[model samples]
Target: MKAIANALIVTIASASSALAASGAAADEGGFLAPLFLAFGAAIIAFQAIPAVMLLGSMVKGFFSKKAEAGANAR
Candidate 1:
């Protein structure tokens, strides 16, 4: 549990720093700025969304299988 807590802290810190740096970079640009930022965001979201969806499906599958097996034994 403590390890998990530490991991969460580190993830939060890293994400904050990364976002701060990206924000600073974006602010330095002119016209085409929002477009580039949106492109980068879309790429990141595309990658993250599929993995999140897969994780959710896996968790749901695990419980469904467990329930089915339990019901079969009864």
Candidate 2:
């Protein structure tokens, strides 16, 4: 069962890669490519804000816990 699952995943990956390789054409919408790239970058930048906030909160919580533990030991 695991062998069959692995084979299926490999087949799907190769088929998709082949399809993607054939689909690209040099003459197809050069201007739209940069616009789409900028849009994707903007989306990533917008999503990063929450991730940064979460990391900051996690660091703050970690330090507070250490401080509390030290106070209790004294």
Whole-model lDDT values for every prediction: 0.85, 0.88
lDDT of 1 by residue, 1-74 (tens): 99999999999998997877665544557778889999999999899999999999999888873545666684
Predicted candidate 2 versus true structure: per-residue lDDT over 1-74, tens digit per residue: 99999999999998997888875575667798889999999999999999999999999888873545666684
**Highest TM-score among the candidates is held by which one?**
2
| Model 2 TM-score (2 dp) | 0.49
Give the Å error, residue 2, model 1: 50
* Clash pairs, model 1 backbone: none
For model 1, the stretches where C-alpha displacement exceeds 4 angstroms are 1-28, 66-74
lDDT value, residue 23 of candidate 1: 54
Report the alpha-carbon TM-score of model 1 versus the true structure.
0.41
For model 2 the local lDDT of residue 35 reads 98
lDDT for model 2 comes to 0.88
